[model samples]
Target: MATFGVLVFPGSNCDHDAYHALKHVMNSEVKFLWHKDTDLSGIDFLIVPGGFSYGDYLRSGAIARFSPVMQEVVRFAEKGGPVMGICNGFQILLEAGLIPGAMMHNEKLQFVCKNVYIRTESTDSIYTSGLEKGQILDIPVSHGEGNYFIEQDGLKSLQDNDQILFRYCNEQGELTEEANFNGSVDHIAGIVNKQRNVLGMMPHPERAMEKLLGSEDGKPIFESILNSLSVA
Candidate 1:
């Protein structure tokens, strides 16, 4: 079985959520990599789970990006290992320059926590290998600074390279402004790195692993990771 590592920052509240989703729900091997640790020995896949890391000080992920383990994470991703960052984890990836784009406060300048629909824009990344193009997923997003922005050139680059993976959309899978709760540029909710081994997204797939909690749309994302690794 492939072993997954969930990074734990000082204030990472979602580490356990990722762990439970992977270990209990998916029946996969999961381990926690503390912020202070520099070694990443046995982890096959790495997840930078969400939460107010470092109390979201200075910036959402500014402090957490400087964590000791991030060095290894950067190295891991550079070596083509799969690394996924969700919500605050996404912020960290931005702060660490793992992916292009900057995060801003919600368009309403308020903390938004609710279920939202996102359309799968691309299935070229490791996390979405099992999903189909234009698939609509019901996932929950809870963040104040989830708005994603990029310069015109950067946006064009992402578009040209097929890096954009998920876009906020209506239940009917329409990319309407009403579905853009965070007002991210082009309704982008998730994106992958140039190599496609790293993914950064605002939605919390870990929170949507079970139908009892809300939706099971998040299961396929995990399954995709496992399936991709097995194929490799």
Candidate 2:
């Protein structure tokens, strides 16, 4: 059976959400892997779940990036395996070099938690394969240090490589400056690397998996991943 490895950091609080999202929602076998373990030879996909890893000190995801499992995540991503990092996981991916840029404190210096719409720019990556370019999704965003920052050249490269995946938007599903959740470069809410298998985003898609709470768009992201892996 195909299995996804979910990395657990010391303070990872969203590992269970990832498991639920992938297993109950996406219908895939999942293995909870410790951060100290570096070997990930058999997992079909890798996920770094969100939470306040390492107490969010030094910087969000800063200390957790040095965890042994990140080495494996990096290796897995390098060889074309799919990986995703949500919220704090996104921060770790950047620090581990699996993705680019760094997340700093929100410009408002506050932790904002609410449902936000995302404007999709790529539907070809493993994470967003079922989405349409320019499509809009309503997902929840919850964090204080999700301000994505990168050098100008890196930002340009992201654009050139089609790495920019999603951007925050308003309730009307329109891209507006007021809806830029954090001060991310070019209003980026998520990104994929050049290989397109690795994806990182600040929004908590797992939180939006149920229609009982008024949203289920996140279901497609995980579904697309499962389909891609099962087919591959």
Candidate 3:
């Protein structure tokens, strides 16, 4: 069975949610890796779940970037291991330099807590292998700083390399300004590293795993990881 690890920081409220989503829903062996630990042995995949890590004092994930566990996460990603960051986790990844770009406050400068649709832009990575291009997923986003920003060259690079994973879209999969929950550059909701081993997204797929939660679109995201491991 594939082993999954969820990194837990001091204020990580969504750690349990991610653990349940992977352990119960995906039937994978999951454990919480505290931020203080540097060891990453036996873990096949790692996740940084959404939460107000370190109280989001200086910045969303500024303090958490220096945590001991992040050192191992960086090494893991450098070796091509799969790493995923969701919401605040995405902030951490950006702060830690695992992925490009930075997150800013929502365009409306208010917290957004609701279901939003994201269209898959690529299926070349493990996170989206089970999904098809242009497939729309209804996922939940609860954060104040989810707007993604990057320089023009970086944006062009991501586009040219097909590193973008998901983009905010409407119910009909149309990219529109009204559909953009956050004013992210190019409406980017998720992106993978150049190596495609690390992914950072603002949406919380774990929160959308159950039908009772209003959508099962998130299931494919987790299943895709398992499928990639199985094929390996």
Candidate 4:
């Protein structure tokens, strides 16, 4: 069985949500890895979950980037280990330079907390391998700074390498400006690293893992990781 690790920082509130989703919902072995730990031994998949780490001081993930465990997370991702960052976790990945682009305050300057539709852009990575292109998913996003930004050159690189994983879209799976909740560049909702092993997104998949929450679309994201490990 694949062992999953969810990193826990001082201000992390969603760590347990991720733990429950992976441990009980997905039946995977899961553990909370403290921020001070340096070892990532026996962890096959790592998650940097959402929250206002370090009280979001200076910036959303600026302080959390220097956490002791992040060094190991960086080293693990450098070796192509599967790592996922959601919401503020995405901010951390950007701050740590594990993925491209930066996050900024929402265009509307308000915290967005609602279900948004996203279209799958690529299934070539472990996180989306079980999803089909253009499939619409109802995922909830709650954040004050979720706007994703990148330079033109880097944007071209991402497009050229097919690193984009999801885009904001309508319920019918049509991309539209009105569907952009936080004004991310090119309506991007999620993206993977060049190696396709690391993924960062602002939506909360762990919040949508069950039907009782209104949607189960998030299951395939975790399911994909489990499926990949079983095959390996």
Clash counts for all predictions: 0, 0, 0, 0
Candidate 1: give the clashing pairs. none
Cα distance off (Å), candidate 3, residue 16: 0.5
Regions of model 1 farther than 4 Å from truth: none
Write model 1 residue lDDT over 163-192, tens digit each, in one string: 999999999999899999888999999999
C-alpha lDDT score of every prediction, in listed order: 0.95, 0.87, 0.95, 0.94
Displacement of residue 54 (Cα, Å) in model 1 is 0.6
Two-way TM-score contest, 1 vs 2, winner:
1
Q: Per-prediction RMSD in angstroms?
A: 0.6, 1.2, 0.6, 0.7
Candidate 2, run of 10 with poorest lDDT: 169-178
lDDT per residue for candidate 2 within 1-232, as digits (tens), equals 6899999999999999889987887778899999899778679888888999999989888899888888778878898888889999999999888888888888888898888889888787878888888888999888999889999999999999989999888877687888986777788999998888889999988888999977998988887887777788
Question: What does the lDDT read for residue 231 in candidate 3?
Answer: 86
Candidate 3: pairs in clash: none
Candidate 4 colliding pairs: none
Candidate 2 local lDDT, residue 79: 84
| Model 3 agreement with the true structure over 15-100: per-residue lDDT tens digits | 99999998888788998999999889999999999999999989999999999999999999999999999999999999999999
Better of 2 and 4 by lDDT: 4
